[model samples]
Target: MSNFDYDLFVIGGGSGGVRAGRLAAELGAKVAIAEEYRVGGTCVIRGCVPKKLLVYGSRYSSAFADARNFGWTSDSLRFDWPTLIGNVRREVDRLNGVYTRTLEKAGVRIILDRAVLDDPHTVRLANGDAPISAKTILVATGGHPMIPKLPGSEHLISSNECFQLEELPASIAIVGAGYIGMEFASIFAGLGVQVTVIHRGDQVLRNFDADLRDGLAEAMRKRGIDIRINTETAGIEKVDGGYRVHFKRGDSLHAGLVMAATGRLPNTMGLGLDEAGVDLGWNGHVVVDEFSRSSVGNIYAVGDVTDRVNLTPVAIHEATAFAETVFNDQATPVDHMMIPTAVFSDPEIGTVGLSEESAREMGHVVDIYKIVFRPLRYTLAGRDEKMLMKLVVDMASDKVLGCHILGPDAAEIVQMAAIALKMGATKVQFDMTMALHPSAAEELVTLRHKWEAPTPMAGSDAAA
Candidate 1:
């Protein structure tokens, strides 16, 4: 028998930590999981789940507009912020209860307090409980949105605060152009608010493929968002009504609200990682091996705290692998490659595998197949919106390298494509597949011509 009180002690009741703890207990190991906040963690509490609900709420305005084209005489429509906010909060609370019950049912001790490392094998609870001893400890404290320090920065809010706003502002000035900033911009604009986006880069979504970055920016602008690229906020000042955001170019933007979605940093501070001698990255993310093992053999970490893949599903995957490796005696390593992802912005974005730039940078001559066309749904609605789909292939091997889509249901479409890509599907194989009739996805298998390079957009960084 082990000399410790528990076989596994998990810090942070986020997706990864909870999964590992529950799995270990089900596998006949003593487990205890601690969380200072709600059990559902960031994804359910403030990130993907709540955010997607808001996205769904925001889309109804467009749905109402399109309904007229379908001979529906619906009128007298309105949106109530309080109703949506209250509903989202209730859903979150329900999920929290579900997560807590799941742990209890699995026979994992649920400690509703913060757990910090006392040493390699010991953790101390904030509630003044006796120090918990375990044969293995896992850190999955996740991350928090980062707001940069500037003059009058106290007036700025992060994405975490966006959900709790007492009332939706008439106008909101977002202070970054990354996924969070762009997504919130789209959400607010869709709900009939004036939105302005400020970014230091030339375009938004900087890390995505160039086509997606440019296409999304154009589409957002067309939808009435004021996008100020190649710009940075110098400071903020409280005015009579709201806040005045001063820019580096000696200009100022006044809005009822200011939100900063600049980035996220691992929540590793004050966790006693330094005294425990676990290695961390420069950004304070716990450094772990492919198997999620830390420098100290018995101490491991997963999820955002490790900074490998910040997606919630990826964290769960790592946690499953860790449990199998440690408790089940089956060595497993989490694979992080070719994961499918989505951005729930206006129009949406879905992508998987290497981007064209990265594929070319790796010395592969690429064949690009791309199309921009209106979806069938827009034909009767008379909406001028267009969807973009592109495939990047390695010319020499005909291996599909990337699939990117920016349109309605892009996430659902790319999810299936990810399966084929993961299975090493090639250009010839995509062509050989039978097309489903009258579907946007059928376009994937029907395209034949290799795209000829078009003249680059003026002042654009995208390659031909």
Candidate 2:
């Protein structure tokens, strides 16, 4: 065939690269995947896997409190950070081994070294291995947390550092109110740490359904979390006790640790993408076509490195499509629409499709169905927090355009909703379906009334 050492050379052994490598090798392609760190990439390492384990561990604190209302009594309660984190790390190690075994079983050559593009189809490994050539190259480097540039910013740590802390701090100040920051805020707060979340925006979870965004914040506040909105950070400085997060306007806040969870940038740097003629977007994202093909004929990219969706499942989805398209000769493009997503915050959030704001912006005359009530589980536990369930439907077609939820098991519930939305299920179909008794998700089918939007103020702009 082609004059190359391998059929595929995948850089960055994250989810996408691993999936592509395995699938391609399964199809009898000579595939090699390179990951500088451990395999399983961010999700299995410091991202979702470890973070979700921490979420599960953090919830025990609330569960213990709630158990008192359920007639369970315990005079002494203690949490060991070392035990939790150590167990989590062990699980991560297990997953890494699982992923490695998967690649090996699929006949993919795994390279434990950093790989850079020498040309469009040639790669150079950092461990002084001979340069390898392949017919096709893939970039799936993923991303890293973006720490803000300000004076004394060096004092700040990120989500990755959260897992590496030797001991849990007495208090933590998380900068940014995105999903990552809010999730950690929930974690630390649950673990009995005094936690403060600071964001420059006036609201938390920007771009989510407005009801869920505001409702979650209020519930978090009631749980004793200090959420500082419209509060800009000037810098971080070392203080006598710990660190002070200086505000751009008023009052500096002190904490044992300061974390910057503003956002993440694509890990497209220092990999010689430019030298290989691959285009990068504003945030070092590998610019690729719908087929994930780069400007260089045989070069392609996916996952957070391409910045499309940025979810681990999405990356795996894209990688699967890549393998099917390239090796199996099936021309499949990724479908980004109606993807369900979740935030592991205090009450949790799960949403699929468009928000009401997004639907309206797209010129959909939407009828919003929204309900807020304390969950049945919360009543017995004496938890005051409420659940928000909302649906955005196109008035013209009666088609359900969005589903948003904030409550326990929201993510689980939305997974079912995502299937409905993907199949273009209508409001009438949702209505006709019998709701399961005594479940929060049945609210999706039970909602009958349309929520009325508040009329615009006399001087304020709504038409504008």
Candidate 3:
């Protein structure tokens, strides 16, 4: 290994790559990380950080609207789009510098060029640049926004580009109903934009609990977002000042801007994975084992490139586990199950473990406990927003299989529930725990009645 130029070579200086590279270097291994883009990757540069900033900016609009109800009076309110965008860009740039400094402080060699695997142990940088060699190579190229191939798809902007818009559009038509799509919808709708969401699926968040799904849809609709479910975008054409979005549902909508939040694909293109013997999945995600090892014996992959969960925290966990496995000689594996996640959409959604539908599908007799009520804060503000909490339990084992929440601060509350679920807390254990009065989180442990019966398995394949 001493003869190799680097003990570990990381492609993509994203969350997982940076963590793995820095940790491996800290463990006395010669490490190098190559990134074609910014050091902080998607979460910092575009996805999480900027999105949250926009969400924060958009929330002020509602705050002002609801302020009058709370005895606070103000004249006409104004929002300067450039001011917010500039501030967010400055913050992102500062964070990017911080990530760079952190890597440098950890003695991880940082290369600012795209990397292509020349072989199992060698990677060639972009241009006719020199190739670097390492004993072990890790691919964490993350993912890119997947633009669907519609007739005039090129006319549509993506969520990535949407963040950098100079001026906020008066009306925006967002295509897709996933987290990203729904989040942008909430942001624009809150910001006084005439927002319309076109989703091909029957439900917005298909993976979340059904109760939360219905709750979020209702909340967004009440907020004045025109949500057209089971609708497909056929094409787009330039109209007067705005664009006409033709749909398969026999209707066309006009909007000043169109955003495509369809989904993201693994950023494996031009990486020379085939040339390096790394196998990719059907969706182009790099196939990796529990240990994050790719098909190439000396190479490994993690993060969005693997398309496993595709969350920043999951990537960080995998990176730490990768570091431990390689440098510390610990046989650690990333336990993806029970990974908690949150959507920052209005009336945010949070969940951990299995949904009732999924648990029953897995042959468990499940009992669902749920509650929906207006929070105490809304009473004072004269707002009608409702808080929803649910717990899915395996009846046979009495173990809490899942927890879901839809309300204000749902993310913060669900995180605590995630810890309990991680520790294998059962419904009885939750019941035994005392409730924190006047708190929405307490509902998780205080739900007394069984809300629904065991969901019958779909079709006649229950026995099979």
Candidate 4:
């Protein structure tokens, strides 16, 4: 008989932890998962799932306007924030049930309370009667959004609170130009709210290709969202009409709400990682090896808590790789290279492989192929919105080092492109493929010009 209560004790019901626990149990090992809140964690409860639903809700204004240009008649458009929020909550609740039931059906015990490390191999539950022992313990507690320490910060909201508001604000000032901030800006603007975005950096989506970033910024400006770059918030105060956001340079703006999406930190505080001898990074993320094993041999971590690749699919992939290595005797290590990612802001963004700057810095002589033109749909609709398609190719090997797109369905197109990039597809191969005529994506295959190497690309200053 086994010496422990279970083979695995997973502390987190997030995507990574739950996937690990379920797969381990299915592999015939005893498993138990403990979660303090809802089982779906950030993605389902308050992150991607709810955020995407809001993105969809916010797009109807454009659709309504576009329909008229397409010769389709429509009724007066109205947006009900409460109704949308209520439905999104229902969907989240249903997903929570599904996650819980999945674990139970897999014969994995589910503990609906917080669990922390008592030692390398012991888990102490906040509300349970006794400590649980397991051969291995996995920490996948995920992360929470953080705001800067400014005067009257208590009045500011984070992404978590944005989901729970009773009513939509008439206007909002968002600090931080990351994907989260930009996404909220797009959503609020689409819903007819006055939106202002403030960022200390000169550009939004700082990690993306330069052209894509600037294109998105121009698009947001064209949509009437005011973007103030290289600015910092000094304080906030409740005012007569709403709130006043004071800037460091003695400027201010009045809005009904202020949101901070600066960044997220791992949810590892007070979980006893130190006492268990698990090493963490300066920013409090758990430090793990290639196999996702922590400093302590019997303890492991995955997902945002590890801070390697914070996307939900990457977390899920890491968990599957963890289970296979530990339980199936496959000794698998997750391949994070060339992982495709998307930003769901207005006009969207999808990218895979290295950015052109990174590729060049790595000492690759690159060939750039790019085009910016109004999509065919906008031609008939009489809109000036532009779509950008770019490819960064390693000239030496002829391999497509990166694919970046900015426009409607950019995320969808990039997801398919990721598969080809992962397979080491070459620029020649891309050219050999037939174009699906009259599609925004067909531009991917039809580009003919190779941009000269000596000509500095626009927006490259921010690339570094």
User: What are the lDDT figures for the candidates, one per model?
Assistant: 0.90, 0.91, 0.89, 0.91
lDDT of 4 by residue, 1-464 (tens): 99999999999999999999999999999999999999989999999999999999998888888878899985866788999999999999999999999999999999999988888988898986699999999999999998799998988999999889889899999999998999999988998999999999989988788988899999999999999999989998999878999999998999999999899999999899999999999899999999999999989999999999999999999999999999999999989999999999998899998888889888999999987777767766777788888999999899999999998999999999999999999998999999776677888887667976533332211111
Instruction: Candidate 4: list runs displaced more than 4 Å.
Output: 453-464
lDDT by residue (1-464, candidate 2, tens digit) is: 77999999999888899999999999989999999999999999999999999999999988988898899999888899999999999999999999999999999999999999888888999999899999999999999999899999999999999889879999999999998999999999988899999999989999998888899999899988999999999999998989988999968999999999999999987898899888889888989899899888799898999998989999999999999999999998999899999999989999999999999999999999877777777677988777888999999999999999999999999999999999999999999999887778888897788988742221111111
TM-scores, all candidates, are 0.97, 0.97, 0.96, 0.96
Q: For model 3, what is the error of residue 329's alpha carbon versus the real structure, in angstroms, after optimal superposition?
A: 0.7
lDDT by residue for model 1 over 307-355, one digit each (tens)? Answer: 9879998999999999999999999999898899999999899999888
Q: Which stretches of candidate 2 lie over 4 Å from their true place?
A: 453-464
What is the C-alpha lDDT profile of model 3 across 26-114, one tens digit per residue? Answer: 99999999999889999999989899999989888877877787899878678888999999999999999999999999999899999
Clashes of 2: 0
- TM-score quality measure for candidate 4: 0.96
Candidate 3 global lDDT: 0.89
Clashes counted in candidate 1 amount to 0
